[model samples]
Target: MKKSYSIEEINSYLNGELIGTTTHLIEGPEQLQAAKSHHISFIGSIKYAKYWAASKACAAIVNDNLTMEPIDNKAIIKVKNADLAMAKVLELFNPPAPEFTIDIHPTAVIHDTAIIGKGCKIGANCYVGKDVELGDNVILYPNVCVFDETVIGENTVVWSGTVIRERCIIGSHCIFHTNVSIGADGFGYRPSEDGRGLVKIPQIGNVIIGHYVEIGANSCVDRAKFSSTIIGDGCKIDNLVQIAHNSVMGRFCIMAGHSGLAGSVTLGDGVIIGGSASIKDHTTIHSGATVGAGSGVVGDVEAGKTVLGYPAQDARDMLKQWVAMRQFMKKQ
Candidate 1:
């Protein structure tokens, strides 16, 4: 059930300045445009201030720097940053997580040589292969599969229908969502000399995932042909993303939904790959680089640069090209 709070209570919780009436009760938060008289909203910047005049919200959490003034009937809680304050508000209204018992289910199959740790929960029909090591507090949801010789560190949660192939190394506090595939065979093949179709290259390496990584549902990380395919600490990969064989991602990199890195691609720390972006094989994206949505990067990207469009170039250069083409078309 949603809780209702007085304007004074919310202002105190946010440690923000209160304007106008304090007796109004706020049921919950909603977007400014869609908010009702009982719902509270936020105005984070001057650009959004225009919406306030048309909004029906009885109260709003607004940024202190925004030129929003006190109105006759409504309340305003002015904070240092509206977006961050909204996050705190959301946490206040967050729901409880699903509960799982700290015991292995009867249908789970564990090999004799597998080492299960303290407080681990293995769900129904899950398979833990021989010599697999699960550290303390690991949770494997129903129907998950772990192949032989895999080592999953403490407090990692693997959701339903996920699979971890043999010899993979997973670090602590990682969350692999449903249907995530780790250490799958790389797409490597060569034409045979004897008129046969092709020969598959053996994928002998594993995947090494660092701590605090969260891989979304349906994402796949392929095993390397030689060494390990590495995902560094704090990396966040969105749903349906693909990390090809031999790819290396540095700490805290973000890959949006449907983004993909071809084999042998290297991404430095803090690189942001937008949705549907694709990096070519052997491409190196330096630290702090941003690949715009739907971009196709075919070459190396310099540090701190933002690239856009197919065969990605600097964002400013791409914008200039578009402007020039528009002018040329107008003359014709």
Candidate 2:
């Protein structure tokens, strides 16, 4: 069922200055162009100022600096930051949570030695290996597998087709999306005695994921050869990402889709990696650094710097090189 909130209620929730009628019922949020009556839209910049007049939304969230003519029957909520305020409004209209019965399904295969905590929901076809420990309210969806001796903390959710390999330690409130493979064997090979073929190195280590971490669909975090591969608290990894053996990611790091970290890579707190970027093995990305999309990072990235392009360098230098190359191409 769709939920509705009055303009006054939304304004109170957002702590925004309300203008126009406070009695309008807002059903949901929509983009400026698509918004209709009873829907709320947001304008964060003057670049979108023109859309405000044309938007049919009964209410609009606007930045404090945004200046626009008001339309009849429409309410305006002026906030210091429209984007952040819109996030709150969207949450008000979020759909209901999924209902999972707090019981182990008959089709689930749980070892006798495994410890299941209170309020956990082990779905059908799920496998809990020997000595595995699941904390309270942990939900393992159908086909999810927890390998031997793995420890999953409270309120964690592992979606269907996800696998948590042996000895991995996952903290509370973490989310592993569908098909995510945690603690998989790392890519480590050595030359054979006769040099005819490669010999695989045994991956004896595990993965440690901290509280409130979220790994998106199909991403993989490889097990270490010696010590644990660590993902710190509040890290958000996008779809199809790869975190190789012995990698250590600091708190609140963000890695976008298709980005990868080679073996032993270290990311300091709050580092941001753009989509399709690749960080070579043993490199360190300092705190607050930003790596642009499609870049190849071969060396350490200095703190707070933004790098871009193949063999990533300072973004400004890369831009200048691109301009120079374009000019040379035109001359030819």
Candidate 3:
């Protein structure tokens, strides 16, 4: 059920200064164009503020830096950062997650040698293979599979149809969305001795994921050829992303949807990969580097640099090149 809060209560929750008065109750946050009279919205920029006069939102969280003439009837809560404040408001109205039974379901299959910790909830049709160790309060949804010798830490939740392959080590407070695949064999092939066919190199390594990692649906983390494919703490991988074999992702890295890292690619802390970006094999992206959407990175990126274009280069250089090309085209 949806909950409602008075304008004053919402203001207090945000710790923002209330600019105007409203008796209305805010049930949820909505987009400015789609907001109803009972909903709240945010104005984070001048582009969005233009829609405020046409919006029906009962209250709005406005950026403190933006100057807005007070409307007659609507309530305005001014905050330092409107976007961040709206995230809190959304959490306030967020509903509870779907409840699974507290214990292991009868329909699930568990190997006798598997060690399941206290308060672990294994849903129907799930399979726990030999020597698997699951920590306390781990929740495995239906149809999930854990291969032999895998270890998952406490308070991890894996949604339906996810698979954790052999010997993978997953840390605490991790969330894997539906259809995620962890520790799949790396793409390693070489010409056979006969020189007629490709020979598959054995992928003997496991994946090591640190705490507080969240992998979105359909993403895959491939196992290494020898050591480990590592995902550091607080990494967030979006849907359809791929982390290839031996790739090392540092702490708090964010990979957007469809972004991929080729084999042996290394990323330093706080690297942000935009949607559909592809990093070439053996390339290193240093700390705080940003890869623009649709860019193809074929080489190393230095720290704190933003790269763009197909063969990704510094963002400013790419922009200047585009401007030069445009000017040359006019001479044709």
List TM-scores for all candidates, in order.
0.92, 0.96, 0.97
Best by lDDT: 3
How well is each residue in 1-332 modelled by candidate 3, as lDDT tens digits?
76999999998998999998777788899998999989999999988888888888878999999987557668889999999999999999999877876478899999999999999999999999999999999999999999999999999999999999999999999999999999999999999999999999999999999999999999999999999999999999999999999999999999999999999999999999999999999999999999999999999999999999999999999999999999999988
lDDT of each: 0.94, 0.94, 0.95
Worst 10 residues of 3 by lDDT: 67-76
Residue 314, model 3: lDDT of 93
- Candidate 3 displacement at residue 180 in angstroms: 0.4
| Counted clashes in each candidate structure | 0, 0, 0
Alpha-carbon error at 199 in model 3, in Å?
Answer: 0.4
Angstrom error at residue 77, model 3: 1.1
Pairs of residues at least 3 apart in sequence or in different chains that clash in candidate 3:
none
Writing each residue's lDDT as its tens digit, candidate 1 over 27-79 gives 78899899988888999988889988788888889999887876767888899
lDDT of 2 by residue, 1-332 (tens): 87999988998999988888735688999998998897899989999888887888888899999886567888888999999998898788888766666478899999999999999999989999999999999999899999999999999999999999999999999999999999999999999999999999999999999999999999999999989999999999999999999999999999999999999999999999999999999999999999999999999999999999999999999999999999999999
Query: In order, what is each prediction's RMSD in angstroms?
Result: 2.1, 1.4, 1.2
Candidate with maximal TM-score: 3
